[model samples]
Target chain A: MNPTACILVIGNEILSGRTQDVNVQYIARRLAELGITLAEVRIIPDRRPVIVDTIVAARAAFDHVFTTGGIGPTHDDITAPCVAEAFGLPWVIHPETFRLLEAHFPQGEFNAARQRMATLPQGAVPIPNPVSSAPGFSIGNVHVLAGVPRIMRAMFEELAPSLRHGTPVASQSWHALGLYEGALAAGLTDIQERFPGLDIGSYPFRRPDGRGGVTLVSKGLDPAQVRAAADAVQALIAQLGCTPIEGEPPP
Target chain B: MNPTACILVIGNEILSGRTQDVNVQYIARRLAELGITLAEVRIIPDRRPVIVDTIVAARAAFDHVFTTGGIGPTHDDITAPCVAEAFGLPWVIHPETFRLLEAHFPQGEFNAARQRMATLPQGAVPIPNPVSSAPGFSIGNVHVLAGVPRIMRAMFEELAPSLRHGTPVASQSWHALGLYEGALAAGLTDIQERFPGLDIGSYPFRRPDGRGGVTLVSKGLDPAQVRAAADAVQALIAQLGCTPIEGEPPP
Candidate 1:
């Protein structure tokens, strides 16, 4: 079985509709490439109890738990101390992180607020930040990352190599123009039953010209099974009187 | 206190990194406008047990629970039946939904798979789908919506009037170029303490001209409190030697 992971997005901006999260998609895709199954994503607010509770729950459930946001220098940035509390560890300042931040800032520019970035959970290891000086940390299986897209991507890339991986999933898609999903649902269900190991999904898309179509995707750990299912889906689309197109159709 | 809501996004495509969700942000913004506090968002797969468990938990936790995706005609579309099971109601064909689908499809074109769209929990009220013939149902406080962006928006707008609301949140923002978030964190923290009713957040941005800046936003139910916090934030920026702009900087 593949190792599973969950993402905890800790930010009030997301819940408030003030910001759209790109971190979940980025981490999901990256974890997929690393052969880890991205199981769940929870977008919660910056509240202390909620964050701590979510972290504990996710840590117990998944092999790896990644949290983004609330790691900045501001007051709302409470992820570090809260995560420490979740693991029953003391929130302390890391020496290496403090040195890195001190070197990055100008003379006397690093104040008490800026120094908060250096504080992490006891026994936590730093996740380097290429975009800025503030570093994220990892305690146990939870890897904390910044909410900013660029910084999150950089931190994830740097930390991904250390994570354990499983068999990478392979996927293939077949699209047919002018094909309604409802019309093809029965056939798709039959195909899904035939290949129980594979996951089959049908999505409908509308074109700018007012034409709509359906796209059938099959994914699995076995490449051959995925290919066979894709071929069957394509044949099914052809049987429905529509030409099958490889990949997604343009809008 | 504002009435709270939660969004449950049910789809494998989102967890698999094949699709980026826009529904959560849309729902959050709309709920905020309706004076509903969107407390949490959970993105989970189309699994039966997971969906049922999440639905039950969310219904118990929030005043309103909105779910998007898995209400389609395909086999992966299992949300309706799962939701029915969650409420301990037998899944039955909603008569009105069947009538609507029958009228929408041509004679003899509505297949068994299409008929599945009419299925809903017993005693559930149908939420009209203006974009598609298949209707989403509402049982108790849980309002199920479509996965497609356009259809989801239409369904939400139609149902918004019936939902209980609180005082609408008011917000104001101040942007300043050459202002680092770390530098202004102390002052922002002070302002946040002073305006206990407001939610103050600091976000950093990279401008097109390669300049970095921060945008401080204050949100609250009281307009005067929001405005007061916003003014304080602007003054803090000016005191730090950066002129504050009233809104978002041009990308």
Candidate 2:
């Protein structure tokens, strides 16, 4: 069975609609490639009680819980403290992190705020950030990463090797222009019933230039089953008098 | 008090990381303009029990619950039935929706899948879709809309006036190039302490071209308090010897 994961995005900027989140999609794709099922994603404000409660709950519910944002040196960066509270562990500065950060910053410049970045929950292991000096950390099932895209990507790479991977989940899709979803829904349902383990989805797309199409997708851990389902989808498109095109349509 | 709202995005494409969601940000921005506090956003798959449970919980917790996706004519479109189960209402065909859909489709083309779009829960009031003929519905506080952005935007615009709005929340931000977050964290915390009512946030941005900066933001219902906090942020930027930019930097 594939490991299940949840992403908790703790930030006021995302909730306030002041910032667009790109982290969730990036992490979701990576987790998929690593054979983990991305079960749920929650975006919440940077409230202390909310953060602590959510961390406690999510850590128990999924095999892995990735938290992004609220780990900066600013006053609003309360994720580290909240995580410590969640695990009933003391928040302390890691010796290695402190050393690395202190050396990275200029003399007399590593203030209390900068020092906060080096602090982690007890028994936590650091995930080094290649883009930035300060590191992210992992405590138990919860992996904490920075909010910045570049730093977050680097931190994820550092921690990816430690994660347990199942059979890599993959998908195949076929699209046919001018083929409407309602026209192919019945035949698609038959294909889905045949392959109960696979997730067969039918999506209808409409472009701004009035061009539209229907894309049928099949996804599962087994590549053979996924491809067989896609073959059925391709046949269905042909049966409906629309030429089946492999993969997504033109942008 | 502001009426709190939660968004439930129901789809497989989003969870699979196959689609990058633009709907959540659009709805969030609209809710902010209408003075609604977007407390939470949850992205979940098109599962029956999960959708039913989430709808029940979110409806009870917040003043408004907005759901996007799974209202189309495909087999994956299970949101209508799940919502019916959530409310414990019979999944019935609304007479008005049935008539509109029947009139919209050509002769002999409104199949079972197409007809599914018209089948709403009992006591559902239709929210018209200007982009397409099929209407979304509002049953209780849960407003179910389409997954497609163009259609969803039109539906939200139609339903916007009906929603209860509070004092419009606003925000002001000042950014500074080459200003690190650690340098201004203490001063920003002091500013936050002075204006306890406002949410003052410090964000660090890194560009691909190697130019990095910090953006300080203040947000609240009262424009005066928001502006006052932003003024303090600008002063802090100047004290650090970086030019205080009036707003977000260029993309």
Candidate 3:
């Protein structure tokens, strides 16, 4: 089975327009690069019950589940306990995390609020935060991360080396400015049939003057199949009387 | 009670980083302006079982649930039937929608693929798509919208008039230089207690010299409360011997 994963973005600030979420795209792209299929992403509020329910549901469904946000030092930062409850683990302060946090800010009292960041579920491993001392946690297949894009990227980079990767994923696309989707449907369908594993997407674009066109995307793990199907799509577009401009090759 | 809602963004393209899901921010900002608190946002893939389970879960949790993506004319567009299955509604094409779609395409075979966009749950009311001919649908309190940002925004604008709004939302913030969150914890907590309904967020900004300062944000529907809390935060920052700068008001 291709390792499928799901991401849960937990924060009301994100859904409330109080904060914009840029982490989803970053995590998704990184996961795809590592040959992990990011199957789903969920954004929920800071509510405990909702967060717990989503984590439980997503973890059961996907091979690996990742979460972002609500792991901060505030009243709304309830992700630790919620995730702990979801996995039936004990919520407690991890000694190693506490020491790391203490070393970072040794001059003052740790305080009840700041200490909240050190709490993790029983048997959960801490994902080191290079930017901030507060760490992320991983329980089984679920990797809980921070909401800040900078922190999230750092956490993912630290976590990536340990995760199991399948085939490296890649994608390619072809575009034409003067053709309609209906005009190329027959040919595109033939290309799609020839390369069953490649995901084919046709996005139609209409100009200000109502001129029509479509961009066909071919994505998969097999580089040979992707290139072959993309070439077929381009050739097919040429036969339809429209010169195809190939977009950026898949990375 | 204040009206509230949540958006569920479903697609592998979004999770895989192939497509940036702009729908969440669009819906969130729109909902916030309409005085509808967006409680959560979730992104799931095109899997039928996952979609069905999420729809049912979100429906049970929020007053109104809006879903974007997976309603297009493709094989991955499984949202329509999954939604129908979740609510136990029969999935079929509404006649009026078919007429509108046929009118736009005019002389072509509507075909099985194009016809797929016309299918929705029985008893579902069509949401008018001002931008595209393909219609969105509303069943009970759940509104199923297209995933494309331009299409989703247009469809939401059509549905906005019918939604029950409470109070128009507003927000304000205070910025300060050369102070860390640790430096103003006590005062920030005091501001929190003074404006219990308002949501306050502290964003730490690192200056060029490796020194950081915190930007305190106060948000709520009540402008007076926002102003009062913001003033208090500024005054508190000034007391810390840090220069307080007034931040721009929310747009």
lDDT of each: 0.91, 0.91, 0.81
Give me the runs in candidate 1 sitting further than 4 Å from their true place: A248-251, B248-251
Task: State the lDDT of candidate 1 residue by residue for B108-221, as single tens digits.
Answer: 988899999999999999989888768887899999999999999999988999999988889898997888888999999999999987889988888768888888999999
Clashing pairs in 3: A41-B43, A42-B43, A43-B41, A43-B42
Candidate 3 lDDT, A1-251, residue by residue in tens? 57989888887667777666788889888888898988867677767788988888888988899998878776556799999999998899899998888888867767667787898999999999999879998999999898877888999999999988888777878887887665677677778788888877766655668676777888889999999998898898899888888784221
Candidate 2 segments whose C-alpha is farther than 4 A from its true place: A249-251, B249-251
Native contacts retained, all candidates in order: 0.78, 0.72, 0.44
lDDT, model 1, position B27: 88
Q: lDDT tens string, model 3, B1-251?
A: 56878788877677668776677877888888998988877777667897899889888988899998878775556799998999998999888888888888858667667777788899999999988788899998899998777888999999999988978777666777776665676677778887888877776666557666677887888989989988888899889998787765221
lDDT of residue A150 for candidate 2: 78
Compared with the true structure, the alpha-carbon lDDT of candidate 2 equals: 0.91
Supply DockQ values for each candidate: 0.86, 0.82, 0.44
Lowest lDDT block of 10, candidate 3 chain B: B242-251
Cα lDDT for residue A230, candidate 2: 92
- lDDT order, best first, reads 1, 2, 3
